[model samples]
Target: MSKSQATPNSAATGAESPDAILFREGMSRAAAAVHVVTTDGEAGRAGFTATAVTPVTDSPASLLVCVNTASRSAQALLANRAFCVNTLGAEDLALADIFAGRTGLQGQDRFTVGAWEKLETGSPALTTSLVSFDCRISDARVVATHHVIIGEIVGIRLGERKPPLIYQGRHYHKL
Candidate 1:
């Protein structure tokens, strides 16, 4: 997890700035899908939990993933050049917690949280995920406090009538 940094602002007087408070407040209200990102590299197999995953565009079949530089898994993803985003289900709370850094499991240890398999692109897709996207990263940009990764989807393992796990107000919700 990336630690929140104090942004220097001329308008702000105290420790917390208006921009920081508003950003957190906005994120707190916005519900997001829970996903586990996995990658295999020459260094080793690595995976991490991410809630900042979103579909960017379909014209090029692409999506955006925001990864914190503080995470070792981010480096692994950069080295591997491929990754899979496993969209969680309502029953995947245990798996989500494990990957979300709430269970104290790091790196490959988190893989033991659930049954995993590989897609055609060789990225690890959870066997029980609601949906899985196998992608090769096309570009990466470090913006703000995260690395915004752009990936081109080449394969998809879609589920049937599966609802996604959601996170809102710092808590998990089932859709």
Candidate 2:
């Protein structure tokens, strides 16, 4: 998610540069675990499908999640100052689409499809997730069009170890 930006070469051409296009195409081939990051607080409830979550350290039990600034859930996630990264299993493909905005279900409505519960941070943790990292936002930085949030893990909920849901070649796969 913290990919280095392509230098500003499109100003004259008014089109995406070749390097940026190729980078995206190459990245698409790289498989990543799917996750539904959910949050709830004064900003209400919000969730989104993300492949940008990763661990930063374990001493303080921290992880990083990247969210697009333009996403509808961005404001709530930032304002809430907490979130849960629910690592999906193979069975959760439809749930991923629901949270990813493909179903047109906005805000709290997306929670209707899943069995969710709050952990230490009061963020919604999917009961069926392979694992749910409930965290408090420790730090945040804006890089390009995304918010790179570092979260301190305050709790973890482990579910059955099942085949993981992955995204690659712009499609969902199970492994």
In terms of lDDT, the best-performing candidate is: 2
Cα lDDT, model 2, residue 80:
96
Against the hidden reference, what TM-scores do the models get? 0.86, 0.89
Could you give candidate 2's per-residue lDDT for residues 1-175 as a string of tens digits? 3346554567787977658577788789999999999999999999999999999999999999999999989889999999999999999999999999998888888999989999988999999999999999999989998999999999999999899999999999999
TM-score of 1: 0.86
Prediction 2 TM-score vs. true? 0.89
Off by over 4 Å in 1: 1-17
Candidate 1: tens digits of C-alpha lDDT, residues 1-175? 2345445565665555547676787688889889988888675788877888989999899889999987888888988898999888988888988877888887778887678888876778998898899999999988877899999998999866677889999899988
Question: Which residue pairs collide in model 1, if any?
Answer: none
Look at candidate 2 and tell me the lDDT of residue 106: 83
The true-versus-predicted C-alpha distance at residue 69 of model 1, in Å, is: 1.2
Which stretches in model 2 have alpha-carbon errors above 4 Å?
1-18
Model number with the top TM-score: 2
